[model samples]
Target: MDPRSPPPGDGRLTPADLRLWAVLGLALVFLALAALFLAAPALGALIYGVPAPEGIGRTALRAIGARDAALALYLAGLALFSTRRAVAIVLAASLVIPACDLVLILSAGTAAWWQVALHGVSAGVLALTALWLARRNHSA
Candidate 1:
C-alpha cells in the first residue's frame, strides 16, 4: 500500500467526521463570542469595531451574547439529532445575521476595514460550508 493513499477498503475521507468537525468549529466560535460579549462588552465591541456603550448598551451587548449562545446550542442540537442537509439549511438561513452585522458595522462608521472584512468573510465561509454540506446530501 502506498503511504500516501488510504487502505484499499478505506476512502480518502470520512465525511461524517469532517461534518462533525465543521459543526464543532462553527459552534465553538459562537460560544466564544457569546462569552466575550456577555463577560466583556467593551472588548467584544472592539471586535466588531463598535463604540462601547456606557449604560443600557451593556445590556444590549449581553443580549447579543445570549443570542449567540442560543445559536451555538441550536447548532449542537442539529449536529446531534439532524441530518447534514438539515444542518446545511439552518446554516444557510443563518447567513442573514452575519450579513446584517456587516451592514450594522458599516453604518457605524467607526469600524475599520478589517472589522468590516471580518463580517464579510464570516458570511462567505458560512455560505460556502452550507453549500458544501447540502451538496454532500448526507442524510442519516
Candidate 2:
C-alpha cells in the first residue's frame, strides 16, 4: 500500500470516534443549558443557589449564560474543525471552569451538596476524557 493511502480501517468507526461523538453531545448539552440560563435567569440562579438580589441577579445570570454559550461554541468548533490533539488540549484546560465553579459554590455557602458534587464530577469527567483523547491520539 502507498504511504499516502488511508489507513486500513479508515472507514470504520472506533471507540475514539464514539467518544468524540459524546464530547459533541456534551457540547450541545452546554448550549442548551446556556439557553435555559438566558431564558430563566431567576430559575438558573435558584438552581445554583446564587443570590439573585432583585436587581443584580438577573444581570449576573445573563452574563453567565453568555459565557457558557461562548464556551459551548468554542468546544463545538474545536470538536468539529480541529484535530484530536487540539480538542484534548481545550478539554483539559477547560477543567478550570468547573473547578472554579465548585470553589465558588462552596465559598458562597448556599449551594447544596449536590451542586458541589455536580461541579466536582463534571471536572473529573472532563479531565478523564481529555486524558483519554490525548492518549488515543498519541497512540494513533
Clashes (N, CA, C under 3 Å) per candidate? 0, 0
lDDT of 2 by residue, 1-140 (tens): 89755344433224468666767877887798789789988777776667665676588788878878987888778777666667777889889988888778788998987777878888988897788667644342
Alpha carbon deviation, residue 38, candidate 2 (Å) = 0.5
After superposition, which runs of candidate 2 have C-alpha atoms over 4 Å from their true positions?
1-16, 137-140
TM-score of each: 0.84, 0.81
- Per-prediction CA RMSD (Å): 8.6, 4.7
lDDT of 1 at 64: 82
Q: What would the per-residue lDDT of candidate 1 be over residues 1-140, giving only the tens digit for each residue? A: 78865334323224455776787689889999999999999998988779999999899888889988988988777777666666777889999988889888888889988888888888998898787766644443
Clashing pairs in 2: none
The number of the candidate with the highest lDDT is 1
Candidate 2: C-alpha lDDT: 0.74
CA RMSD (A), model 2? 4.7
Model 1: how far is 75 from its true place, Å?
Answer: 0.9
Q: What is the lDDT of residue 82 in candidate 1?
A: 61
